[model samples]
Target chain A: MAAGTTSSTEVPAKGAGFPPFKTETFPSQIFWLVITFAFLFVVLWRIAGPRIKGVLVTRRGQIDGDLAKAQSHRADAEGASAAYQSALAAARGRAQALAEENRQRIGGEIDRAKADADAAAQVEIAKAEARIAASRGEARAHVAKAAQDAAIAIVARLTGDTVAADEAASAVRAVTGG
Target chain B: MAMNPMEQFTIKPIVPLHIGGYDVSFTNQSLLMVVVAVAASLFLTLAMSKRSLVPSRAQSMAEMSYEFVANMIQSSTGEDGLKFFPFVFTLFVFVLFSNFFGMIPGSFTVTSQIAVTFALASLVILTVIVTGFARHGIGFLKLFVPKAPLALLFLLVPIEIISFLTRPISLSVRLFANMLAGHTMLAVFAGFVVLLGGAGGVLSVLSIAPMFLIVAIMLLELLVAFLQAYVFAILTCIYLNEALHLHDHH
Candidate 1:
């Protein structure tokens, strides 16, 4: 086929005049053109065209959809982070409030117990003072009695005679008072 | 031997026919047109048969061409301009294949003919005009109305109108001329090798220069083929852009 075509098209230097300039050939050329081009347009429009376009449209759609998905994912991540921050702050605030409340309650309990202990000590101190006063009075009484006995006995021995009780008490009281 | 470089472009009748008064014969141009369409269709069909997300080489190629034109439309006319993707893609593939097919040793380049390019160029302009009018109403004609002062409107508006009218001509000529010139130069250089070889042994040795030059031209022609196809598609995009959204007069 190649050889046959090559020979046929080969330098057939026999053609008369410039074929392009000749007007005689325009009709057939134009006719075939109308027929062939119209046929080509139809073929392309009906078959070749939509096929390629379908592929292209689908590819473009896939790309756009992917981009949108990525965008939504990023937005979701951002929303999650914001939620975490707010939740964390809220949790921290709640914990601080609980600690402050606990501290106040404990401090109030300590103050009340301290005041109660001070009052109890005051009452015990009053009782202790009364017991000390009573003991002192008893000791004082014993000492006075001893003085009186000692004086009276000394006087009786010196005089070689016993004095009267009322007189001895009077002498002891006077001397002690003196 | 004297060679005619213009001879390759002849639209010889492979199946001559007549319909009423028209010479609607099947010519080499017609043959290549059908061939280009089929080849393009087959490539797309086979490439996408699996429709794998991770494309095979052939699938990548098909997708690459798809994205290539898609980007062109997007840049020139925005996403809304994608409405013309099928037409533009069809035009791109057809022109690209036809240009490359012509580069083959024994195939006719459909783009070499003025009629073929003119038809395509006209079709583009027609689409722009119709769609522009339908969408924008009389504002479509505002394409010719200049934004300059009334003093220059006399000059700018006329010039804009003429330039707009000449679009199809210029567009058609650009592709046709490039293909025609490249092929003609290659043919001329190839003829030189034969001409030089016939002169003498020493001249035949000198013929290697022209022979190598032909190779170089062939490579250049390959680049031109792809570039011309790109230029055609991009220009169509730009034209469509103007029609879709009436650009400010510049």
Candidate 2:
């Protein structure tokens, strides 16, 4: 009956001034609230909560596993380095021992060679002395013979007598000896 | 033109429903809450579906929310208070998203509603009371009785009991008042911009200042939204912790 009186531009009358404080809407709002809050709580508690928690737990486990693996690897590396160090030290000690042994052997060989050379030089000196003595004796005999001949020639020329060569030689030899 | 800022708080049914003598229509406020709740839940679900060790950006967000609430609960309630993790988590995310949704240009802020906030606050109080009784038996009454001297009980007990009774009101009013005041202030300032610019003079240019202020306030509101959610969740955790600890020691 009032349809003809309603106007389009007229702003419709609102129920209450402040809707939040409106007693009428309270039940519906709270009703929807209970439903929505319950839905959200269920979703979080049953699905979202556990899933996120699983991811977290998995990530943490992964971290802990990786850390343990890294620690083991580090320990292995330290052990390897220790072994390498010990091996190097042993090799250095062996090299020092080898050098000492070689030096001692070479020194002993040098001392033996020096002694042999000294003995050969002494033999050579003795042979040379013997030969010099022999040569000197021959030279003296020759000089004695020559001196007797000269003395005989001189006596003969002065006294016309060729005395016995043996006697002259004997006299020359005795006079030189004296 | 004196725009009514209070009108923005009015609830109108987008889809009207009448059951018996009751009005349970899917109103704008309910719609706001439903959409926010569903959207938030869906976002978390989709983000965490992968559960990647190396989280995607969305997954990081989901994980951040999880850890943020989880850690807060742990600190306040320790391991035991985690029993209420679902409740606290749901409350925090819902209020947080609702606050943020309200920040949108013309969206309704569900948390600003006294009825809604009071309902949530009442739920927390109910949980705390039930939990306290269940955990501590009849000794839970001691909560109203402070550990001070008997003469001091004359002053302390009444204070403790009154404060306890006021918890729900305080909690609800805090969130409701904050959102209500913040939104109203923004609307008032926006109304200023409209009025000043409508005046069409140097005042139009002056509108820029309020516009900029509104932007800054918006950024502040974003922080406030998160902060309020954090406070609500942490407080819930602390209350639950009190129920679990029951006077801290024998």
Candidate 3:
């Protein structure tokens, strides 16, 4: 099979276009193959390899960037949800506190009103008692004065004009049938 | 009539040049390789040069060829495989044009010859070697060894080594044998048609049957041409896999 290297059929004559290499020589096809291989290696290493590497690197970076962005967005969304929850709690607390304060204030006002009413009623009752005492005293004084005047008038009529003070009292008592 | 149509399948010299113990003959085969290479480069470059957004017919053809290589790379090696697009493209175009060109009468099929196939196979192996070395450095030698159950290494290492060496041989033989056998059969059948012909010879008329069979075989050969190119590129990808993913201990 080594002689299978003789790829040419047969060399006929001088003018025949025999390949530069013997049929048994290095395969001419190997020459072309080497040339092709070298050319491709250079082409790929220089142009295509760099481009492909660039694309792969860029794609990787893009994926990494996207994942980072997604993570950040998730954090932001969580923060927003927490903020909303806190705000809602604060608003509810404020409303409840306001209601409680209102209830306490109303309670304080009702107590004050009751105290004022009690004080006013006490003052009114004291005024009524003072008025009743003053009227009773005046009536007692007027009754005494009227009784003495009646006694004097009866003594004068009975003793005609010459009766003495001591006699007059006694004569008045006798005249009136006391 | 020639004794055998296979006999006519010869590579005689067209121009003989001798240089110091070197038998340098410019033969039909060499001329055809030059033609195949030149035509491939020219056709693609000329057709794709304008780079129009809306492709012209020539540009469409160029784009189709580009798409073909690109798709082949993607399918064999996955999308990450697009990195090898240009190399794969050039190889496909060269082989495709050469195979089709060989089908023409009087044209030499370089790929049909073992030397040509061997050269191509060697290139693939060389790429694997260089890429593995470049990618893995000295660690590439570790490809032959199993890192686990040291006893299993006894069983696996030699087989692994043999398989590794066999890549180029199998790659070359598969392409060469298919191309050579197909062409030879066609020639042998054509010879039958000629040798059996004569007046009142029923056997001569029956020779037409082989001609029909040859036509069917030719169609099969065309399919083989595409298939062989595909196999070569895919095998390159598999070899590249070794470079990308080093063997685990197991």
Candidate 4:
């Protein structure tokens, strides 16, 4: 009994449930292999391949669309920037021109006013010079008349004789001197 | 000498079936792989058949799986990621179901076997290579040459090429190792309980502790199931990105 038990234990349970298959043989391995490969290729090709391809195509389209949109946006932004710069430059030029035109208009008004004032001052100076000359001439004449009247009164008193008013100046002088 | 439960790890030929000069013996392991695959297809079909707006429990689970895979693809690959959603989703479901099916009593783990895991990894790598060539043609060879300082290129290029080639191997090994190690541990621990219980030793009852621990580990393995699937799919996405962009992300 001990020997029986030892042999069973030592023999390492062989062929109890199922039989062993050989792998070294070429035909059997190739046969099973062909079966597995054919099944895999068919299943993968029919079921999985189409779905994968669809997904890839969709993704490629999306990326292309995004790139196109980005390019258009860049172009729009560049155009806007250019437009803004041009508008800004034009506005600056217009502002400078308006300011220059305003300055010239103001200067022209001031110059015209100054010229009118000078002309009026020259006219007043001319009137003042004519009045001064006339006043000087009248004063000289008054002094000469006064001196002749005093000489006539002295001659008339010295001569003690009747004399006409028109001839009194010369007659009085002769009378006063004699 | 006591007969351990794990003595069943040895390969045993059952049915003497030959196909085209090759021995295609039906083994316990292959039966389990079929069971896992069939169970997965049935569950998904039954769950998604209703396609209800307000989902039933099974339908919700199905929808959740779909949406989860969909979201992963979209986030990782971008909106263009939609193309690969179905492939990624199918991969996630198959791997997840295979992992979960292994947790059931008396089922074989297809992923635990190197050949199965390698086959899956090869498929992913093949897709990457094919897609790269399809998209970029011969220029795809540029993925190997690093555009760096001329001096650094000599050092970095060889290392990069090796790492790139290691991807499929590492991917296969990660899944295979995890499944193998987890299943082996559970089997060993289970053997402890069975062997000890038969002896009626005090430690026989104490096996309950490790038994409970094993159950917990199984649950953790289920979570690992989802995680491994996600990692595999995401790595595919990363590789696909390298192919699409040809910018060998070192």
Best by TM-score: 2
Each model's TM-score?
0.71, 0.91, 0.59, 0.60
Which candidate ranks first by DockQ, i.e. highest?
A: 2
Name the regions of candidate 2 deviating beyond 4 angstroms. A1-13, A148-166, B19-21
> Which runs in model 1 stand beyond 4 Å of their true positions?
A1-15, A62-178
How good is model 2 by TM-score? 0.91
What's the lDDT for residue A14 in model 2? Answer: 46
Q: What fraction of the native alpha-carbon contacts across the interface, defined at 8 angstroms, is recovered by model 3?
A: 0.10
DockQ of each: 0.19, 0.39, 0.05, 0.05
> What DockQ would candidate 3 receive versus the native complex?
0.05
Q: Categorize the docking of model 4.
A: incorrect
Interface RMSD of each: 5.7, 5.8, 8.4, 6.9
Q: Evaluated against the true chain A, what TM-score does chain A of model 2 have?
A: 0.78
User: What residue runs in model 4 are displaced by over 4 Å at the alpha carbon?
Assistant: A1-178, B1-15, B248-250
Model 2: per-residue lDDT, tens digit, B1-250? 5355666687878898877878999988989999888988998899999889999999999999999998998988788878788899999999999999999987899999999999999999999999999989999988888778899999998898898889899999989988888887787788788878888989899989889989988888888888888888888887788788877834
Ranking the candidates on DockQ from highest down gives: 2, 1, 4, 3
**In order, what lDDT does every prediction score?**
0.86, 0.87, 0.68, 0.66
Please provide, for model 3 over A8-124, each residue's C-alpha lDDT reduced to its tens digit, 9 standing for 90 to 100.
234334323322223463544465555654554454445444443444455568789999999999999999999999999999999999999999999999999999999999999
Candidate 2 residue pairs in clash (backbone atoms < 3 Å)? none
Per-candidate count of clashing residue pairs (backbone under 3 Å):
0, 0, 21, 8
Candidate 2: deviation at residue B140, Å?
A: 1.2
Candidate 1 CAPRI assessment class: incorrect
Give one digit per residue, the lDDT tens place, for model 4 in B26-145: 555556545554555555556655544446887567556656777777766667656766556656665676677777867666566666667778877887788789889998878888
- Cα lDDT of candidate 4 equals 0.66
Q: Is candidate 2 or 3 superior in lDDT?
A: 2
